[model samples]
Target: MNTRKILYQFGYRRCADQDRPSPARHPVIVVGAGPVGLCTAIDLAQRGVSVVLLDDADRIGEGSRGICYAKRTLEILDRLGVAKPCLEKGVTWKLGKVFQRDDQLYAFDLLPEDGHKMPAFINLQQYYLEHALVERAAELPHLDIRWRNKVIGLKRRNDGVTLTVETPEGSYDLDADWVVAADGARSALRGMLGLDFRGEVFEDRFLIADVKMKGDFPPERWFWFDPPFHDGRSALLHKQPDDVWRIDLQLGPDADAKAEQAPERVIPRIRQMLGHDAFTLEWVSVYTFQCRRLERFAHGRVVFAGDAAHQVSPFGARGANSGIQDAENLAWKLALVIRGEAPESLIETYDAERSAAADENIGHSTRSTDFIAPRSAQELRFRDAVLALARHAPFAKRMVNSGRLSMPSTYETPLSTPDADEWSGSVRLGAPLPDAPMRNGHDQTVWLLEALDGEETLIHVPNGGTPPAGRRVLVIGHDLIDQDGFFARRFDATPGSTYLIRPDQHLAARWRHTTPEAIERASRRLKGLDGEHA
Candidate 1:
């Protein structure tokens, strides 16, 4: 059996030529081919918008970074046509255990209810997730992913943006009607624009090691606060695909990152945790936590998403998940603006919605970071007291923030129309459409989300007649059976309730009974259009 680690590389193709005639202007140019950029490009392409994706690297992420993916991210991936492979290759876990100094404090389950299509969380190597996105992007003809193409300079023009991309052959100029910077946290594009990212950088550092080991440890997240093996520090263990485990150990602010990553120092720590079990170290990295975001995600014709827009501590797995959501939110809006279906003012809402999401992620990440790494002795004592009480006290259990974990951010923006009639369920305006099992006209089981199919739709529960002209209506009872009553219950649907859903699957508005005129008004408002023309 081979112990060597296999790294997959997506070979680079030279698409930019300095010697050729002036390049054609693309509708959209997405910087960075990471998950966010790839997803954004694929989404726009699927919406019939041609996109050019540029990345400096020819390969996916090297290590098992960002192992935990939330259900919302999975749902977004489902629409991108890569969720099936991701679900198959990922480790799904909902239970998490927290400990204090070798004693079990409490354990909790993330998803206590059912009826949803996806699980609460899945642990998958970032590389695998990126591979899936890349494969999906390749299937779309309108998406051109050019690897090893670095953007060295950018200028926001009146009508579009011009980017100077450096390829292996030579540097060439590329112009785009709009630019999306989904590059990583150290975004060159962000720097080129002379923008500043503001927030706090925690003094603590953490060592992340991915080890291949055959162990009896169950597939769950285990967090230890000051375990006996590594005194006075916290450790986290998460199971990933391919029998590899991700271990994150907290090292104080002053610890030497280089020395901590040395095999001699890391091997002994692993030996203590696993009790001399046989394991091979696959990857190791030391990182500091920072909760930061740009003041605005959209800057003129150039927009930002993923780490380029906001960055948070790794504790909550918010970084990648939030970035994916950012891509999901911006892709449809950009497509609409590019196609003239919506006004360019709709693009400003992207800044409004995603910047709020960035703030939410940053806040959660900061709190989780503070809980895990208390700033003072009094704070540490308070954390320990909460952990101790969590062992038996129900109230204390809720206070334990090993990491609040990632959840989808609901937008309270001008786009989402407030509920016109009273509703009973948790799915509200500005929320992602909840998933429920149903049987389509073909009499085969299907998910309500699958029926959405990335289109702006109006779902009329218990069957309503044809909607207004140009509106796509999916009558629940006529087109699909609400199997198990899940759809009705989850959506709080009354007999005549009609739901208006956006192309990104977010709930735009709902009413007990509405007219075509009302629906059209709400739809137009959702696109940032005004007045009688709307």
Candidate 2:
């Protein structure tokens, strides 16, 4: 049979499991206990929903992948109460430098704004991040983390989902009101469902090595384009915690992995870059990857998060960060649905919002790849010329700085509700809504984000006087004001700038002035007000 017919047969088999299901009903069954799956399970458990987390691996942190975490990811961890431990355990870097040939000329600092709650970035391995999440999941009584258990089958129906899981001991049948497939790029769940993951795959390969080096290199991310000896390749030297420095070199199209790892092949690059600095190699691998994204994030009852939904080139560290954000967006919506507060359709927005963000990441990473990859002698020459220009030209410096990283995406969709008065620069929808300094209940001032911890916030923008009727209301620039800095810069509130922030801290809506009806409407949409909106 063809692939389509085989899939149709699998679908029928799983549907039979669903139709014959007994009266036992579980809250949620999440497949693949990677960081995304673990995060989803923990978030649901935190919301008081029972969750069963399953993974094929015998233990957490089995995979040696995903080493970088972005600022937005730290915020997601903060929401789950795991960020503090992650910070304590992980190494933080504040500066990044870009180099051309043998000379290093420019540097940029990724410092968190003064008094901001979160840092710019952290370098904790993906396994450590998963381990931290699992620890938190263990504390939540409603959550169950089952390792060495893999999903052999999945079926989606109007009622819910039925899953067939296999263990070393035996195969068992289970049913859930909802299912999330946080499996990686080659998602078995997405494949079984016949969903489309669309994008391009580059043919280039790279070598990443973690080494213990004796060098004068301070803790900073260093990138080299077209260095001596390697005519057309790129290199990254980043220091991880525990004195392990990660070195990445772009191997040529025909470079053999085994040959590249030989002490002769690896040591010279280190010596050339670090100027005869002594170093011992701990681990090495020749890794090749591509950038691609799913055509859709949701198909009926099944949803995809992390690598299952999108894959970006490792250039800008977008893959893991985007996946974590996918979890952040879907977790709350799933909780609301399981709690019977909103329609199951609310989960559909995850596909819409995240797919757009994935596309943006795809573009950014692809551009970074093109600059790093050398196609021909002329092309390599052009790249060298560009880097040489960046050495002396201010415009070239900015161009390289702009491509150094990825940030939170703006919600450009029509589905997104906009802020009242549009202020320029970084505060747009889909951007991070940072906290400004404001007063707390004790009359002592604190950051607005600090003051609004542990609960949802509804800022009331009273115009012509008459406050909206709600307990969650914070009267911005009136009873409450932001005077210190850019706290209310994005809101552009002159007295009346209302915003309803979700528990995940994204702005649900903003208005010049809010009514009881509008506030209730937005709150209900977020599952904060039961089914009142519907």
Candidate 3:
């Protein structure tokens, strides 16, 4: 646990639950205070669910891990009221460059379009993101975040679960109606449940050198395959906040992990890469990654999220972003289930959708890893040829993989109502709604996600028609004023076009010309109240 800066620390406090005759049963119990766990607790607490968040560590700062936060993650953070601090502190970038040796083969824009609030991604230390979530959690009275409270043991029952939590003094028991396992990849809960977390385990290793240097390198993601400085190995460079730069150098499968992380070995590599010794080593570690996950995310009353449910190469930047999405998808459905508004089967969608998402991420990460570290001579030659061809051939640019960047997952589940009418739009029925700038009722310009704001909203361009009953409808010309025609063009919207957006900002259904009855049916179907969605 080497950290350049200690950002957050909390003292251990004895709770009254330890002395209760019967274990205090909470509506929801969240394990691990990492980004995923904190988000799960905050989102549920905001939905008015009583949550108890437990973490083994007394402080947040560790090595600067998982620095790349995607734009979709920031939008989810915005809904939790904590995206401002992250955006303010993190380094923003959308442009990424791919290189073959010393030559730049290609560059890509993650967010080519405009009118979005957040950038393509931000390189912020993991501790900063955790600190922001912890600060936001303190504002919620119902959310109880306990430091040094670790779930040492768990017992699943028919009604719920009883957990044995270990603290400084001793141990205590807790009963929870539902549990969220967001602990890291080495999860204690996953082991306790007898679930297998086996998948692709990469043999090659990489060394992370976090150096503090006052350099003028523009904030962008730069990846090199067979770079001249790293001896025919891959390397990545990213600029972070506070003049800290993150460098990743590929070490072969047989490299000594312990020796490679030492300052004696790491400093020379850094000097060679930068051609200067002015930078001070802030933090260093060697890691071997994998693309693995459990068979399913949901197991009875306990649901797994984050690294606990899935593991992927950090180069893809899918680990933390997908975990945040897990919190969003599970929180809304779990809230509905706990409130008796939706059947217990709603939880099934969480497993189905997130498991599919995990598979997609694992697939991409595996391919990226294979391409970056070719296993055979033929594979190496193919990868090199692709990199060389990418300089001119547009199709070859698609073949070159320097880690396919993180993107939001589009769920293909029964919950989404398939498009009934032939329409021309980039957005799909189950995909997330593309953001656009619009004017609210107060005549203030806001992002479309902000206007949706954690509610099941109906965006209707009025044709002198009223929307469905029992749903919040935002009239395009009235409540939402679309200027520059970005929203209209993106959604293929017309005067009578209608869309049903879920609470998580995903499109549930849409139509060319729809009635109130159809919208109501789609709403029910989205909630698992009707159709095969249940």
Candidate 4:
């Protein structure tokens, strides 16, 4: 998409906090205005918490960065009331095909089901997403977005964090009961606190060229390994909105970084790949990726999320997708802790769960890099053998590393109650509730996730039984009908099968038969208020 067509700028406006005798304290001050930061602020604002979202820039970013939005992220956007614009303005795809030497290895379907509210993935430019989020933030009365406001200094104390925010008018002391550092990878707050990442920076470089063209290519992820056009290197192609296409060509370690991005150097490469000269270059950049993250996401009163706390190689589209999930994971718990509804120690689970997810993304990305740009001759031979065998050998197809597309991480956290009964199926503890199509009492179609909404919920699939009292319960047989067998087959639903889900829609506990006492116990356990656990 042409950025100038949708370009917008926010002017400087003095804040009440800036004019106060002593800077007024906010319930939460988010230290960036990117998609992750904006989502975090909106999530908190929806829960009735006051938020100040600050960013160093006055407008959306320049390039079409992070075009792939996983289904899980789209669900989160639905909760924020901004998924409609994204679905209307983005390209949706699910088929992924892998090739080697101009030959097809195999194709896989990400979401091969019939009853889903959202698609497997949507390819929307990063700037478009930021615009949608900014609009949603403006709708919430509790959210205040401060453009061109940067957090240059941070001090963490025993109780809260105080920040030095610099703006066009002047610098001011902003005290926040809690701080969210969603700045970019070069996080100023992280540097102010003297924290460094720990992991490896790959030696290979890749070029991202966003091209505008009219082509007949289907909306599918096409990954090539050692293609004839770009001999002995990898290339990836994806379609974005407004006829914009994202192309990534792997450059070996020996490539000259400065000269590779010149129009003269880039245009010929495009011509060679497309066998014509009919495409216009939109954005171009050479990037070297790394697999790294902080030792911990939570440090005292200043907690980190998104790129500020972790980073991954661009393969797999994990960077932005995982960062959005981090915002969802931290938003509810942080809001609860601030409201005194949950123990302070509950914040530690955010670090534990998302750190595990970061490690998983880094592992997948690191392996994809190693396979695409092998570090040694032996590894190259192994990759070649796997590619050759993938044509017929089903086992070898799983070995291809064209970036394992992003998926929701099944967390191993302290909040989940161990399954007390013998459950069969993919229902795991601490996993996000898999979505299904359902019908409400009015006989209108709805989604399972949307019915639960953004609050702690009780789901009961009854077998000619009524729901238990003492908690708000959604009885499936009465409140809604399972239009499809997804929930029934997945949860192995029987008479009185019950589930307790957290505010973020993750499964906290389950049983074939549950009582009011069990529901209260699980609620306490989810908040980290259990006497022994806390």
Per-residue error (Å), model 3, residue 197: 1.4
Please tell me which predicted candidate would have the highest lDDT against the true structure: 3
For each of the candidates, the C-alpha root-mean-square deviation to the true structure, in angstroms, is 2.1, 6.7, 1.5, 1.7
True-vs-predicted CA distance for residue 129, candidate 3, Å: 0.3
lDDT of 3 by residue, 1-534 (tens): 244766779999999999998899998999999999999999999999999999998997767889999988999999999999999999999999988889998888899988788889999999999999999999999899899998999999988999999999899999999999999899999999999886988899899978999887789899998888998899999999989999999998999999888788998999998989999988899999989999989888999999999999987799999999999999999898899888888899999999999999999999998999998899899998888788889999999999999999998998788676777757887888888899887889888898898888999887876654567988887888998787888899987888999989999998888877788788888888886442
Stretches > 4 Å off in candidate 4: 1-6, 464-466, 532-534
Q: What TM-score does prediction 1 earn?
A: 0.96
Q: Once model 4 is optimally superposed onto the true structure by TM-score, how far is the C-alpha of residue 401 displaced, in angstroms? A: 0.9
Model 2, residue 73: distance off in Å is 1.1
**Worst 10-residue stretch by lDDT in candidate 4?**
1-10
Tens-digit lDDT track for model 1 on 1-534? Answer: 112355677676766445668866899999988888988999999999999999988876567778899998999999999999999999999999988887888887988888778999999998899899898898999988888889998988889998998887888898899999998899998999899889998999898899998989998999998899889899999999999999999998998988898888888989998898599998988889789999998899999999998889998889999999999999999999999999888988899999999999889999898889999988889888888788889999889888888988888987777665667877878889878888988899898888998889998865345544567888877787896988888888787788889998999888887788888888998888966373
- Candidate 2 residue-wise lDDT at 315: 80
Per-prediction TM-score to the true structure, in the order listed: 0.96, 0.87, 0.98, 0.97
Better of 1 and 3 by TM-score: 3
**Ranked candidates, highest lDDT first:** 3, 4, 1, 2
Residue 270 C-alpha lDDT in model 4: 93
Q: Distance (Å) between predicted and true CA of 291, model 2? A: 1.0
Ranking by TM-score: 3, 4, 1, 2
Tens-digit lDDT track for model 2 on 1-534?
001111100011122223444634677888877788888888888888898887776654332357778777887788788999889988787788887667886888886466466778888766678778877887999987776667888878888887877776666788788888898987888878888767888878888777776656787778877667466567887777667677788886777867887777777877776676576776667777778877888877788888888888888778888888888778878887887867777776677778889888898987777778856678667666777788789887766632457577765544336455655534455455765667655567766665555356777655678766646767765556666646656456556766777766777677766577777676765553445435
